[model samples]
Target: MATILMITGDFVEDYENMVPFQALMAMGHQVDAVCPGKSAGENIATAIHDFEGDQTYTEKRGHNFTLNANFDSVEAEDYDALYIPGGRSPEYLRLNTQVIGLIQNFFAAGKPIASICHGVQLLTAAGVIEGKKVSAYPACQPEVEAAGAEFVHIEMDQAITDSNLVTAPAWPAHPAMLSQFVKLFK
Candidate 1:
């Protein structure tokens, strides 16, 4: 079983963060969820993003997720894969130097990475998606292109895999995304 590292922070999408963590564990993979500046046992708030016939998604309070790993102790090489969930958190997480470095290390090691929705923001900030086809929320197309990567406008329920990266437009693509991501370990 692969040991995966999930990087997330406050306001991470509710489904995007919780579903993958639980599902991966149910599949016999070990997933350690962590957040920058937080230690193990700490908790982070989540937000639910729903597209309810509006021009943009609507947000609501979500469950509090607990961190199982310490960010300061995480080493990219210690895990086989990296998972990044999306939400408003990515907008700020991209500003963390350590977070960017951790992402870069994963890319340098050719480790598999599964990122969804706004999660691509971190990848773009890390400069690891250049020349790669990545899928993210529709609003992130500009960021993807600006980072020298081709932005793939995929369906909300679909996912795209390029090299070691598997990405989806949103939580609705969880099945497709996880299926493709797990294959990377094989």
Candidate 2:
């Protein structure tokens, strides 16, 4: 089983984050939700995770993970790949120098990196998506491209793959996204 280090912030897309986390477990892969901060009993607090204005809010707590580890803590050569989920979390996560360093560590080693929704922001901020084809929430197209990536747009299509990277749209595309990501480890 592949040891997948999935990171998040204070608030992230709850469902999108959980689905893959659960799927990886079901597939017998080791998954850890690394976060920037924590709440009760060393667990991270994740709310509605809304960044666009604000619709509704709810707070759910997940166990504390590796917030201190950077690219130097774990090399890309150690892990098989990385999966990034969308949410306002990306905006905050991209700001973490440690996280950005880890992102680059993976790409430089040619390890597969899967990014969904606003998660693309992390890759963009890390300067690892350049010259690659990617897709996001549409509004983020400019940012992704500006980071040196080609944005793929389509209502229904296969996941976009560029070298060791994989990109997909929103939640509706999770099935395809998860399946494609699983194959990367095998």
Candidate 3:
């Protein structure tokens, strides 16, 4: 069983955060969810990003997700893999130095990393996606490309894995994304 660290923040996507956490747990993996500056038992607001035929996905208030671990207490080397969910969180999380360093540590140590939707923003900010092939929410195509990664286009249910990085466009690709990610443990 892999020890997975799931990083999230306020306004993280509801499904993106919960689905994988529960799914992996059901599969016998230990998934520890943490938010920067938050401790165990603290909750963060989740957002629902639904495609209501608007120009983009619509957002609404979602459930409160509780953190089961303390961010300050975790070290990247202690985990076997990393999971980053998408939502508005990445917009600001990308600017967090500690978050960026943690991400860099994972990349440096070659641990598997799974990122969805806007979560790719952090990978861009961390400078780890350079020269890698990845897939991200369509809106982040330019940013991924700008960061020196080749953005892959695929069906919503598909995912792309490049070495230790597993990426999906959005929550719709969770099944494939997590499946590909779990394979890294072998």
Of the two candidates 1 and 2, the one with more favorable lDDT, higher being better, is: 1
Q: Candidate 2 lDDT, tens digit per residue, 6-95?
A: 867655676667778788889888766666544223444443433345443333544323233333345456678898987678998899
Give one digit per residue, the lDDT tens place, for model 3 in 1-186: 999999899999999999999999999999999989899999999999998889999999999998999999999989999999999999999989999999999999999999999999999999999999999889999999999999999887889999999999889998899889999985
Leading candidate by lDDT = 1
Over 4 Å off in model 1, which ranges? Answer: none
Q: What does candidate 1's lDDT look like per residue over 1-186, in tens digits? A: 999999999999999999999999999999999999999999999999999999999999999999999999999989999999999999999999999999999999999999999999999999999999999999999999999999998889999999999999999999999999999995
For each candidate in turn, the TM-score is 0.99, 0.81, 0.98
Decide which is better by TM-score, 1 or 2.
Answer: 1
The alpha-carbon lDDT assigned to residue 135 of candidate 1 equals 92
- How well does candidate 3 match the true structure in TM-score terms? 0.98
Cα distance off (Å), candidate 1, residue 106? 0.4
- The global Cα lDDT (0 to 1) of model 1 is 0.97
Clash totals, every prediction:
0, 2, 0
Off by over 4 Å in 2: 39-41, 47-75, 156-158
Sliding window of 10 residues with minimal summed lDDT for model 2 = 63-72
